[model samples]
Target: MGYPGLHRILWTREQFAVFRDASGQSYVVDAYCPHLGANLSVGGRVMGSCIECPFHGWQFSGKDGKCTRIPYAEKVPEFAKIKVWPSCEVGGMILVWYHCDGVSPTWQVPEQEEVASGAWVFHGTTEHFVNAHVQEIPENAADAAHLSFLHEPWIMNGVDLRHTKSKFWRFMKHHWKAEWQPEPDMHCSCLIVKHSLTIFGKHFPLLDMMISARQIGPGLVFLIFQHDFLGCGVMIHSVTPVEPLLQHVTHRIYYQRSVPSIIPKFLLWAESIQFERDVMIWNNKQYLSKPLLVKEDAAIQRHRRWYSQFYSENSPKFPSQNTGLDW
Candidate 1:
């Protein structure tokens, strides 16, 4: 939903091991081989169409988990079975379902026409990992209060945080949005969010937090984020589970420039600098040390409230706890 690019976000969330195998052509597979329970991802290698298991040179095709060839098997033993997930990259980001029961339901990846459309300018993206949860970070989009503390509102074209308006937005049962009215003294005169589409558009209304910052055009966006639950934390990409208190975080930033003049690029640069500052703040957060909500933490509090959807520590589905790691 942020940018049109795929990222193989290999992350350790909740102490689980996950690998987002994002190639120009997208195909996601369970990191482990179902047959011998080998960590295919650890020694898994990708060739033309097959993902080669480092153990015994067992190779499985990414297309349908078909064992294309087993070097030692006469005809690929019948027991050489592998479960795979067929994934694809449209609009640059790879999309995969996270149903752990091995059921492929009717799920779709976050996509927007402006992502790769010619009308908008698309700048390549950067991938990063945060020590939080995906469910927790997306709420930042709707958070207006944190701008004052986490990000320099003055640098944001002088957005007057004191006078900004906070409104409730519901884009989908799973997504939410918020809008902050710009103040006269603020830098950016207007603050609009245009992402998170509902069934149509009206049904789901997410204030699109800028999608990209590569160019200035009708479609150009500044910041966009779509969860690539290719493997556990957010949906299924978060494979780690330490003690239910801690989790791993991996994220990708698909930013773009909106203005036509050189100013957009400058803004992009400025945003990059600010991103570093935000990272330091978020990383150092005592995530395990839960805090009671406060007025200043309105947006962060909103994030916590939104994340509560999956906040149940007793969900039947827990991390495999079988990543062969001694953490």
Candidate 2:
């Protein structure tokens, strides 16, 4: 990982190097120096807030990415700066994208009030990769049968090692409500099939909320699963496709707990593993492989239909205010 704060920072794909300087600011620059094609990140020197190139000792300000002192030069040239992505902190994690196009993109980061307002319990985040389409990654959240097999829950004795009948479930053509089965501790019985029992850490007492499905744009989707528990709790997960087979799944975990540390560290560690399970199942899948989809695949069909709409030449306005009718 380029950043020092995270538990683990993986460098894969085209990423060459990552660094966080003395200012606590993080930067991910190109691996190979543009000057003479030497890797600047390798054997680079960090002084103050500048990184000196190992090959020529050309010094560049880490903040602006501009070559300030050329060891013996009067002025820094305009093209002295190497490519750098604008990065900032969110939910204890620092994110920086290597965007080449200099277009200052509108903030696509989810406008999360729960996390921003800081009225919740503990929160954390991690980066993962899914070799499948981004849309297909979170699709497992609604998959019923896979849980009994993949996530053999010791919490559910005798429920292990048995594949339950894949339930074909979704919202009514009207508004959708995704709630846990067998009711929660507050114990509400009414719940649709597209819900997992969101136990405090593992299973049970799944918080209830109104679920909305919208493909914001081509290769982009924003699904809203409002978690209204104990008072007010909601988190939005934005699943965006980077490539046809790769995705960036970011979760904004918001909760209303009595105290921050009430949830012990063991549970948080387990929680992270639970999340990694999703990434593993998704990244390893071969979506194009033809498989048997019974009537239970209805939700997948609904999602596919939603996805097809975006490809339409006359696609309707996305992110349109949900009329409280179609979800």
Candidate 3:
């Protein structure tokens, strides 16, 4: 929580108010005041242990969002309460647990030792509101062909089999391997992908990239990227579905404490260049379900299988209406 910090956020298509008490204990609740439907976040003031609605001075308990005091009334009605979400602070972030079935969290967000050991510090955050589904964003992590063609255009000209003109052969030419791990005990999955790019008929050792990512659920992805020359860093990619075809995606990056601040800044700058390029395609490209696959593209389906385990049985099997073969 920051100064005068009554943070208002839109998540899961609903308004929420997040604030901290005098003791620095954080709480998140529905933004609307239950009495008169006034938005609590707009003019609400935090008292010692309650949030007072500016409209009528009605105070709600910070712990449970139950109406604690009514300035005008002697008795507080039982219905004068709002939904209080389960919140916890982890890795310098306030995470609120959400379940569609009104159930408690089945699994907790894993603790990252890097954050606790003080070996890493928060660099910065980059956010993008993509006009695409939430699943598409994580799928890009395993899509290596797009990295060569879109992120690094120079590599495309060097190794593309334009003259040979075999689609399957060309797809297999990209040097990439991805593994998906579903840990039953943890109730999560980790995706490890390693790939190298060729430049001018020679592979630069520094250009090799390895990514280790753990998917906490459909909404949270924690990833660490390592390169031979650029060093290693961790990024938390949290995606929230604002609507059916829209998402609020945030990338929070942290770097080693020993490295200079400028190095992290430069790394993020270079990453943003490619991220924006991917955004352009993600916003426009159609989703395909039974997409024709080659040997190199096997990771896409493997990752999808692991992803589907997160959704409930009532949820649609395919998120997009345009999810058939492109041809």
Candidate 4:
């Protein structure tokens, strides 16, 4: 759940249910009921602070996933418990920790004062379902060369990378310069970008921006954007893997109240169009564990190395073509 105010969400394939308690604390747990294998999220009701199973009225605590009560039975079984996941709410998002080895979270999601203090107003959000590995999505931030070739075209030309290079839109072009580096913390990285737009060789002062993006962990990113005319805002970008090859990506933008709503809405629309161009390529690309790298591609390799720390020896691997059901 990238945004706030969502009470329950079920990932059917993963069998993970994210819900909140009566006091508004969020929790993540295995969706299946421990008693008879009934899906809890399908017909589960929040009774006080516990979740009541729709199948047999079994109540489970959202805090620790323990069986709170079995209405019709004399006593609850000792083994009546669900697998609870580590979760927390921060920066207006409900974040659930996922470690392949069932390890606890080593780092916490930092609270953004602007978001928590009501200083920033949520303007809008955009979501895209992409068929790609989770690593490939964040890797794009470190790939500086792709910015010139893939995203330099005008937004009006459309999201197709092939058609975007047409000479018809040559008069209007986007320019970008970026630098990425890993932070002192092992789990974070920062990308600083300078962007400008030109129309017929004349730069538009209002379109100039300096954006600082911090990638927190493998799936969450916070992009702080500042514009000369439109003021400033923060965009929360999150990536959640639903399957081995499918990911759910979302972007929620919050702007200062002084900035007009139309400014953020327009920016979100334009950003979505540009972002979809990368989505098209990511959906069809294959991940190469070893790739031919050049001098300019050093950052990509460095990013991969940094991201490797998140995996363990027992982490799940994609099944080989020969082993149909090894997983």
Candidate 5:
């Protein structure tokens, strides 16, 4: 990272540099210097709020990305400002707001009590490169059948429970529910899912679980999973589109300090391994805008509909009447 200094990064197929000043302020703009096109992020020095170009000592303001100083020039041109992306620092994370149509952000990333409560510590972080569209990735949350089939807990226990199944038994074995609570006039929704599995097999009862996923737009998803055994934990799943066929995904896990830290750490490791199953399939799958569906695929459609607001031409809107849905 090039912060308090410069850091070079790439996203959406474009190269950019991020700089943080001594005052703890952060800024993101074009990576290369405007004068000679030198990569400013690599060798740039921070002078107060400006980043000094390494090649000629030309300084650019971090706030507006404008050329503020020139060692040899008579005057700094009015058009010396570099392209600056709308950015903000919140909850120890720097978020850059991007709009395809050049619209400003209409909604803010809400603060999470789980992290601010001071009871949770950062457990771990997992990063993965997925060869898929960002929109197609989160839809997996709606695919309930995959949990029992693709990521079955019994399979981890070396028991193929499907072989002993009746349809009702299979349904009862992993009871899953998904509810999409769309926030009025906001580009966000909460997808809550509840499910259970026999982790202890015949030795103990089913491990009941509840997942509350707050999706802020298409790229950021914050998850809180409550379980019968592992207690409560949070995950920040952030995805950035690299290309049409590629994405950068980061998963940050946090757990309450009251619980044994190793338990959540072990759970994070297991979840990392579990995600590989989906990775294998996502890397090879084609995107279908209109996919064939069954009775169990209702959530997929609802999620898709809610997701469309991000890509649509107009601002997100909701019905005037409240649905009385609880988060």
Candidate 6:
């Protein structure tokens, strides 16, 4: 958690509040108070291990979400309670478990020594709000064709893929060779990518690098990058859905102490330029359940089948304009 305070979380039109007690234990509960429907996160205060409602002097236990006290009433009602969400702190994030069927978490978020220990120094972070389905963002890793068509030009040529043929980028280009595969675990996948810079068709050995990314669950990814000149580091990529079609994406980078500080700054800058190219397309594109695919686009269909495990019969679907119903 950020601190011992109340934090509001808005996920897909549902409101929730995360309370961190003085002892650093986090609890997630519905944002609206059960008594009077007052937003708990607006003016709520933590009393010992309970959260006090702002509209009424009602206290709810952080551990079980049962109404502990009501100052005006002599005895609290037996049925008075608030919904409590399962939560845990892992990999420097306070994650609240969510499932369409209200089932317990089937998998746990993995931890890394580079983040738990002080060996890897924090360098920089980049955050973006992408207008797309959460599934579409991770699918980019499996769509290898986009690398040459969208991101082949150097960062200096700007984020517009249409202008990559300009004279300014004639001599500079980026090369990428990547492979994507599903791990043994049904909930996880992996992508291995190799990148290099070429000027006048000559490769620069110093700029060559390899990245191994592990996609965990629906919204978390850990990418480890190794470069001959810049050393090794890990980037934590997180995607949280704020609405049905909007996602909050963040990337945090950490490197060994031997790496220069300036290197990460330059990497983040260049990475942002490349990432924005995909963001522009996702914001305006429509999701096609049955896409017309060619032989070269086989991986895109494989990714869809692998990702289908995240959905269930009760899962929410985007509202369809044709039928005026959720599909």
> Once superposed on the true structure, which residue ranges of model 6 sit more than 4 Å away at CA?
321-327
Ranking by lDDT: 6, 4, 5, 3, 2, 1
The TM-score values for the models, in the order shown, are 0.52, 0.54, 0.82, 0.92, 0.83, 0.93
lDDT, candidates in the order shown: 0.41, 0.47, 0.73, 0.84, 0.74, 0.85
Our tally of clashes for model 6 stands at: 0
Sliding window of 10 residues with minimal summed lDDT for model 4 = 1-10
How much lDDT does candidate 1 score? 0.41
Looking at model 5, report the run of 10 residues with the lowest lDDT sum: 318-327
Which has the higher lDDT value, candidate number 3 or candidate number 5?
5
Q: Global lDDT for candidate 5? A: 0.74
Where model 3 places Cα greater than 4 Å from the true spot, the runs are 1-4, 152-177, 185-187, 195-209, 227-231, 313-327
List of clashing residue pairs for candidate 5: 2-6, 2-7
In candidate 3, how many Å is residue 163 off?
20
lDDT of 6 by residue, 50-103 (tens): 888999979998898999999999999998989998888765677888998999
lDDT of 1 by residue, 1-327 (tens): 111121233322311112333443556666666657666657566666667776767777666677878777678766565655545454543544443344553433334455445334444334345554333344444466555454522243322333222222222222223353322322111224333324323543332233321211111122433322211011111113223323443223333334343433443454554455555555565443255766755556543443344323333332653321111
Clashing pairs in 2: 1-9, 184-187, 198-206, 199-203
Ordered from best to worst TM-score, the candidate numbers read 6, 4, 5, 3, 2, 1
- What stretches of model 5 exceed 4 Å from their correct place? 155-175, 199-206, 227-229, 312-327
For candidate 4, the lDDT comes to 0.84
Best by lDDT: 6
The candidate maximizing TM-score is: 6
lDDT of 5 by residue, 1-327 (tens): 444777778876467778888877898888888888988877778888888888999998888888898999999899987878788764456788887677887887876786777677788888889987677788887676776576654324322333434343433334456676766756777778876554324423446778898888888888887877778888888888876568888888888888898977886776666676678778878767778999878888887888776774533223341321110
**C-alpha root-mean-square deviation, each candidate:** 13.4, 10.9, 5.4, 3.1, 7.4, 2.3
